[model samples]
Target chain A: MTDGIPAAPGTDAWFHDGPDGFVLLAGRCTACGALSFPPRPIPGCPNPDCDGLEQHPHALSTTGSLWSYTDARYVPPPPYPRPPDTEFSPYALAAVELDAERMIVLGQVAPGVAVSELTVGMPMRLVPGVLVSSAGVEERVWNWRPGA
Target chain B: MSRPDSVAVLGVGMHPWGALGKSFVEYGLVAARAALADAGIGWRDVQLVVGGETIRNGYPGFVAGSALSQALGWQGAPVASCYAACATGAQALSTARAHILAGLADVVLVVGADTTPKGFFAPVGGDRPDDPDWLRFRLLGATNPAYFGLYARRRMAIRGTTEADFAAVKVKNARAGSLNPYARFRAEVDAETVLNSPMVSDPLRLLQICATSDGAAAVVLASEEYARRKQRDAVRIRAISAITPEYPRTVPDFPYLASDSAAISPPASRTFRESLAWSAYESCGLGPEDMDLAEVYDLTTAMELDWYEEIGLCAAGEAEKLLHDGATALGGRVPVNASGGLSSFGEAIPAQAIAQLCELTWQLRGDAGTRQVAGARAGVAVNQGLFGHGAAMVVAHA
Candidate 1:
């Protein structure tokens, strides 16, 4: 286990080989062992019964259900990359329900995923996707796709 | 012991709302000066100033309190600019009210003004992975009209709310707005015109949506003791509530949400909008049955239908039926949007909430001509939008 990876990865296996067979990382409360994604920054566990401050990082399951979806019709302002001369296709946005994490993480769906076909309870899997860097450096963003 | 301070609305001013060329700051400044003059004070006399922020304008997104403060001749009064999305103006007013209630200042001015971009306020550009507003627009291609369509369609499916019913609301507001000379659209229209008008989205037409306009509204609020000392009109602002949505705002649940989840626990009380006004009522010690008149954020024709229920006039699906029966008309049980609302007046964002206050103040004082409620003594104003925000305020004559 590579300890102390600053700026925790959303999925555990994200950096191991860079999520082609991507897996997400979450942290579990060492005291209660309750798993959480986007890992808790505060050392104390969220569980009411636990008094522990130590939170150890753990890998979370990548497969989950598509919570909901919508197609964005607007461009987002900064901290996000924008491609000039690239006619951006309006893409599908979805929130996937990762149960073990007990939370919903929102992400852009993979290319050509029809919003009409997506259902509230449909299963989804997170995969490594292209970020198309601002300075011509291809960074990666997480995306969910139907039928893992 | 902190002695509570009550606020009095002195001067209320509104510019004729429409597609004007002037910047929002200019429009708001004119109204601010007019309100100050109405309060028998100059801009320099005000101890504090607050501005409701806007989206289309270049002002708020840049520097707002300074934006208007500079427009009003750099008085250098303590300033705050609030952005509560659709609830902006009320949020602005709420800030001043808080200051007054806390005895921080005796006299304050609240202003909301906007020169809106025509068509819908679309999301800003770029492939943003982190933003929900951009995500909804990009992924769903959901224009503001799409949500309007969804609500209208839902009303039609369940409430028996027809296109004609929605049209009637516009017709009523237009006829009323025509008499005011302050409304953007004055031409009286029939349901036929609404039916025949080109469809911009699924169920709503061009006429059904309030147009973007250039406008400003301002009200000078003074502490109760301060108002008596100044010998000005002593009107009291009862309550202002800015409430956010519950944990999981769902779609079949929320017009803006993409979809709903089957897992999370449902809201224990009322829907988000209903609870917002309900809390306001509890705070103010009044109920919907006691309201003399109301100015709801009628962003769309169908939205007005929902507001009817949210304000407790009727049940969720009964708004359309109530509309057809003439219960919410100009002369109905409770005359809604008595000042042409955002329905007759296209949304002016920051200014819109204050504009609602202006109408309520007039109606309560029995000054609203033609559109006035017969004996309007108590009024409420409600507005909500984008960032899971909702606002409501109660106003009554002393």
Candidate 2:
């Protein structure tokens, strides 16, 4: 995997691969009609009355609106990243609105994006980002950010 | 749930909560033995054992039941381990309670123990987007403190709580913890000390949150007949409720979220924590107002305020007023965290819930020396499992 790909981004297989080779996925309740982006996995619907079960794969919107953003400081432990230096550049973590599922998804802003530049209600897209190593293996991951 | 076969706590034990410089199994074994001794029984009397899990131990949480039993000397009991994040202790005790309550075993030993990581607990290593806990730490760098921070902020927004109001909790719990020999930070703190501490998260200083500790706690639950046969003032676990989150857990809870409802609806205004206590009350025919003493999961100083409302100590937005008015303190109308709570003991995960009972059992029995609630006859312990879950146990003596 190249560190920076202009159009192609993403490292997982839930979402259908596109021209840029971005793969996406979401969570759908087979027991009921609920659709979620990252996917909801509880014993059931979490919706008290719904009591739905079996969280199956659902498709997520490739684009959405920014719900909120915060400049998070601190280098997350392993299974995450270990910045070569201890200097953990605060990244703007955001929850994006995917109106399709009526749910919110969270992701990191693309590597070069600064925290100050982002705002609530900003339009954003699901872009491919570097996948850090996981479970002793390297992989690509997806991130959401404000559109250019 | 039945009179024919009822469950009784026959054994109780624990190691002081702190950097005990020991392994999980060792601590667990010690606590187990204490329970056996307290119940006037032997490990061999236990027909089954259930252990709470700890992630750091790698393999134990899922397989520690037999490990603990073996540590206590190969008693040949059926062993089971459970993992429910913080609620593991209650689950373990609940398992034992079921065994006796179901007439499967006349005597059972339930144990939960953990040696926690020093720093803010993080998800298992690796960049697995599929894992929400890991993703939150990786993508947002939001450690447990961040979530605590969010809750503190929201409490302020929704309830008009202030930093001083939150600090008052630390002062109260610390003073109580100071009297408990098993506590980690025994020094009584003041609101000023809390305000001056380094800020881990906005509106929450370092002293405002619980630390990680190494500890173990065990309880021996027996059938009612077993208790009657022994026929002493044996503490009886009147109720155990392990309830899940409800839809729209809508209690203004985004503060704990590193992200939003990527999955389920927030539970309605009736939170799982609230419902958890409700279930216990239903089972015992009691309510918060009737509680003589309480042991709440003070995961964070601010979270204690949230639990106040959840357990029905007071109505929503009234916890701050209660804290300031000294109604929840040792001398308050209904004393809470009389054993100093998670704030004083730090969190030992699996051991915490059972430990809460250990304190209450001692208090209600009038054995608690300095930290005893004056005439505490009925007590409750409330805890939460991971991914939005809750556990509550009500204990009363006859």
**Alpha-carbon TM-score of each model against the true structure:** 0.76, 0.83
Q: Best candidate, DockQ-wise? A: 2
CA lDDT, candidate 1, residue A122: 78
> Docking quality tier of candidate 2?
acceptable
Across A1-148, the per-residue lDDT of candidate 1 in tens digits comes to 2222322112233233342455655556677675544455457754554677887766656888765565544443333345555664556666676665555665667878866667666799876565543344445556779875
TM-scores for chain B, listed for all candidates: 0.94, 0.94
Candidate 2 lDDT, tens digit per residue, B1-398? 33542367766788888886678999998888888898898778888888888888877655878779778888577888887778888888888888877778888888888888887787766545556666555545666666566557657755778888888899999999999988889998988989999866555678888999999898888888877787644577888998776654433232233233424453255657788888998987878877998899998888999988989988888888888888888878888898999999999998999899899889878888987788777888999765765799998776
Regions of model 1 farther than 4 Å from truth: A1-148, B1-5, B59-61, B125-127, B252-262
Q: Write the per-residue lDDT of candidate 2 for residues A35-78, one digit (tens) a residue.
A: 54445534455344566777777556678877555444545455
Summing lDDT over every window of 10 consecutive residues in candidate 1 chain B, give the lowest-scoring window.
B253-262
DockQ score for model 1, please?
Answer: 0.09
